[model samples]
Target: MAAILSGDRLRFLLGRFKDRLWVKPLVVCLLSIVAAFIAKLVDGTTLAQHVPEIAAESVETLLSIMAGSMLVIATFSVASMVSAYASAASTATPRSFTLVVGDDASQNALSTFVGAFIFSVVALVAVKNNYFEAAGLFILFVLTVCVFGMVIFTFVRWVDRIARLGRMGSTIEKVEKAATAALKRRRNAPTLRGVKLTSEPHGRTVVATSVGYVQHIDIAAIQAWAEENDVRVIVAALPGTFAAPGRALAYISNLSREQGLEQKQEDFDDTRVVRSFHIGPDRLFDDDPRFGLVVLSEIAGRALSPAVNDPGTAIGVIGTLLRLLVLWGEPAVEQDEQAPSYDRVEVPEISVRDMFDDAFTAIARDGAGMVEVAVRLQKALHALALVGDPALRAAAEYHGRLALKRAKAALAMEEDYTAVRDVAMFSETGSQRNY
Candidate 1:
């Protein structure tokens, strides 16, 4: 529970930092102010003699110039990013705008520029006020030079990333990275280290109080609540699940009652469990790989639209999906040294079939007319079939056949039709089956 909470807290903090560019720059400004104070404390006898060449007036002029220029550059950087976000939303789907806006390289570049400006201004003021002795003044000059170097380096890198920030390829990579992380986490703890709730739950059903998608579940809180109530919690709705106001979010089963304790027949408390599950209007990427796949599909769908007519982009998306499926198809390790985090809490594993469908369905539907996309889809499915997981193989086979059928109906050219059907042979358990 501590581990889970700590990890969640760290992830939450990181999400906050990524969303806003000010936090890092704010910290940088504070540190620069502290550095000025620290410079006053350091002795300045020998270093002052050696570094006398750096006149205080020259240092102040340099700092002021850097402060002015960096501020202007930072403003231009923000405007350019806003433009990039708009272009990404217009060219690709708006779903990818969040990733583009929160891009680390661009954010760090802007933060560096802002931080440098703040550092220079504060250091300039300190120098003019004689807050720094000779050594401290020298130290400030050295740090200013270092800051200048960082600005140049960061600006160069930002230039490269800004160009591709909202482009189709970069968007695909961003979504893939996020989905891969989520999938890896799901693979590690498929059931959230709790028993699978297979049959109908026996205890009281805890209905959702609101209508939304389940964004996150506090497993530790649920376990603690279950322990206090002497019950087991069967999670009915995992993250990414849509919950109606009256739908069951979880089920509570009373465990062993104490020997001398009397069992109360009153209502079970559902507040804690309900509060533990966070629901929102849309799905989140942190705990939900399906959302990432959905966005990827949206990108492909836009590419296949008449205005875009970019089958190559769709093919590239299909390739990325194949990589994701391959990572997900790898066998899950069965051994776990530690006990399940929530001994009395149960959670259902995410459905592999659903993930596969979420990933490939729309792309297959939208790209059915293009022979390049159709062949690549079939080949990708056949490759997944080679992973030897029957369920995944079966899902792949189903989508493959469906995509081939769609191609058959949509493609007017016989050569294009033959090209797709030719690659539909799927090998399972040493036996080859043509879709």
Candidate 2:
């Protein structure tokens, strides 16, 4: 359990750090300062004399030019990134801003610019103070040339990426990728490596202490606690659940009832159990597969609005949702069928109906009047119904009927309504009717 908790915690912390804009740049800046001092190691050695005599004026001129140009470039990069973030929020959904901001290419470009600028400034200071011998100056010059080449390479790549970074297609692709990964993770571990909670357990309720979304649940920690206390824990609120002061986070039942009064409800540490659930102001995409689906639907909804009127994007999102949903219906690999790692912890599986609702409900409602969108949506749902999973087929059929009904009402032309109805053809028992 300790090993499990350590790996989980490490992954969580690394994910959090990767999302921050400053962490990479700060580390690069520190490395830049260190690199400036490292060249001084050969200051007093005979190697200093044997090395080529590079003029101090030439080095100074190069460093001065880099310092001035790099600062301006860094400022421009920051402005461009800010614009990209704003465009993603306005064009797509604001919830997608995190994924856009965490883009590796943008962050790496920014870090390189800042790091180069710092290196130039430090090198300039060292030159003016006469801190380096001949060897040190030569090494510094070589490092400066390498830095210049890296900057050029990074800037060119960043230019290409920034051009399409916040555009509709790019945004949809990003959201789809995130949603796909989350869906795959949840599909593999439906109960989070714990026993499935079939029904409500009779136990003492453990309520949350704060108001926020449940971002991460440390099942390993909870399992360890349950094992130590000889209790069985039923997780009431999964990730993405909105938690509040009075909301139940989990339930704890004494497993050692035969051992008598020593293991009673009063002895339970509610605080420890509550602490295992990390609450935050907003839901995260890492642990909450539903959040990603919700964001994708939001983008489609906005595109279908009168102000945007981009049905192509909505159609594209439907295709993306289809790919993600297919993953949900895939059978788990043999490794996943082994015994549960956290036997004492029981967690409820994600609802298939809820997943379909999050992925398609808004798009179905918003795009009902458009014949192109309506036809595409019905086709997508019809395709999902063909997947082998019974639960998936049922949910897909339910949503298909609902979307068909919505289109029939919103679309004025009888021909347009007929078009949607022809594609849907939903029937009970996962069978399709001939049009």
Candidate 3:
């Protein structure tokens, strides 16, 4: 069990659980109940005598106030969060709803309100039933005061966060942050700490059992299975790939063929191999960096739509994409100069061209007629072409030329066409030309 739930797999599961709305509130509620009972332990302690007695009426009044106000506040918070989720889905892309919903400030505030409400109700019930002595009552009073302070602090912070929670700029920023983190992880571990799959895999194919997007691959688990079975596993599908029952998830080749252990390949559990590839109805941003880029592009496309006609937002998204792409192009620091951690597992690297396509293809097509967006995009692409990474330069140049072609066809005015073409000259000649 420990081996199966270790490393990235554990982190992935925890990350998913953390995003749930009920998880934090449930934990906080449990803690609140525990705190209510813990004060009872001070009933026979000498420390209770040292603490001044808190008036029963005063404590009761405070708990009653908290119980009433916190319940109202929690309800208001839920309504506000639901509104924000709807706004994020409507204004931005629906794909970004998860990021908006999983906001830490919003979740923490809701948890605090719910927890405070539970604490007050529980304390009120205990007080009415004569469950606490003078010493226990004093402790409970102090805990109640602390809970009040926490509620106030959380409410203030949450107010500030909720103001901009569902705005387009905030949504885009959240997507960019997610994209940056995923890109950084991929950059550091290009093959996911596995041997690079440079050539076509030649072995027994392991097909997926489900049909959905590949959300994560447990490289450590696959490596363990490979070691135990004396075989080399080549992962065919990376995160974000669509998995189907007929699609090959991996290829297993017998490593001990010289020892006449080839027969063992027939006994390989394909179920175990399929389990390492997590399939979900939708792609996740945690392991699939391209999903972030795609979502960002979707937001830009929506902004550039005929009904929206918000070219400025599209231009802003281009800048955000540039920042992420530049981060991806940066030199990665190697943690170990030796062999990869999962030597028995081989996986393919994410293609830079695909990243560029995911990041800019839709924006270019949607904003083609808008000269402002077109010019800014060409300049952004030009900037990327000079980033010094050959793959980055090539992808940027290819996209730049493609966007220029789109602009030329869409722009009827000669001046608008000329303006975009001059900026795009950098992609063709490696330097911008003065018109």
Candidate 4:
């Protein structure tokens, strides 16, 4: 069955039409006028003898011809012009609208009229001595213009949609990159200038070190020395961190400060420190079930829990841990098993951090129904910004985490109504849930 288009749907279809591109009816109108003129001249000279009565009264005949011909041409012209407007209105979107300067609409309208005049004049000239016969050709000219317009408009939409897809794809890729992070071993470390190795184990032993590397570097000497000395080091430079050649990382022992530097260094600039680390088999210190749990407990106790935070505190802490491990120059997990073995996918855009954000958001605000909160939580990205947009996103995510942050607080305080009011205010599902 052929589906019937509704008024609104039809309008939508028409709006995308290119008005200037479809000025066919106007062209036909101009040709028709030319054809009519030719017909009048031929009829006077050739058919004048046969149609004496019609030709005798020249002023009357001229007036009648003007009125009848004008009425027919004007009706067709109005239909053609109106159709252009209708097509444009249907397809144009609010977001796609860029207010063009100058007078495009008026100019297009004028051009349409000009095209019409050309078609009308040409048609009348072609059918000499027979104005009524020329009128049939005029109608055919109008049909041809409309058909051409429809074909052109149909192709334009497909081209536009393809262009839009390309644009949206690029934007999404950038967003994806900004979201996922690097947990990688370093070589030609770029962003991180060098590493600062502090106090090692008491027994003069060093385990393998980890870090990220952005560029290429000569590490034969560094590797040979570490192997012979029985020391393990890590270089944790990110993928984009710039590293210059011949810059050696500094190994500083007995580092004295307000807080003792025991384990590994942090993410910092390139010019300050120097050192390269080692890579070993990936393994955790212990199979402690309590690793994430302990962090969550601390968070809950300090009001820093992700359940009530925008960027959930728990997820942020985990992300930081991942980042630190990366900086330590460790080999990250494989992105895909089938992917080349040369590299591991440390933080794909859709990451564990993004996952945790969703989980925390669900726990913070119990709003969604008929959906698995945990499944949704797994979609969070691994990318994090400590001081800037990352922090803001984290905060928003925390607020989205659970429904009972304040309630938990109020319940702890023995205030029921205040908790109720708080929950009500923040009960709605957060926008970040989609993220």
| Best candidate (score: lDDT) | 3
All candidates: TM-score: 0.91, 0.95, 0.96, 0.21
Compose the digit string of candidate 4's lDDT tens values, residues 1-435: 011243322432343233234444455455545544543434324443443233223322333343345446445434543443343222221111111111133334333444444543444344343443333433433333453363345335433432332232222222222223222222122212223323332322222234433322213333333333333323332222323343223232222221453533332222212332221122111111112222232332223323433233333433333333233233334444343211111111222344344224433333222122222222222122222345434533454334334344434333443333332323443222223
Q: Candidate 3, residues 1-435: lDDT per residue as tens digits? A: 644877789889998998799999999999999998889998988987698988888989999999989999999999999999999999999999889989999999999999999999999999989899989999999999999999999999999999999999999999999999999999999999999998988889999888999999998889888888888999999999999988999999888885665466778887778898999999999999999999999999999999998999999999999999999999998586898888999999999999999999999998999999999998888888778999999998789889988998999999998888777855443366432
Native-structure RMSD, model 4: 21.6
CA error at residue 44 for candidate 2, angstroms: 3.5
Q: In order, what lDDT does every prediction score?
A: 0.81, 0.89, 0.91, 0.32
Q: Model 1: clashing residue pairs?
A: none
lDDT of 2 by residue, 233-298 (tens): 999999999999989999998877845645568887878889999999999999899999999999
lDDT of candidate model 3 versus the reference = 0.91
Query: What's the TM for model 4?
Result: 0.21
> What would the per-residue lDDT of candidate 1 be over residues 8-64, giving only the tens digit for each residue?
546754774676767777777787667656656655457667766568897898899
Clashes of 2: 0
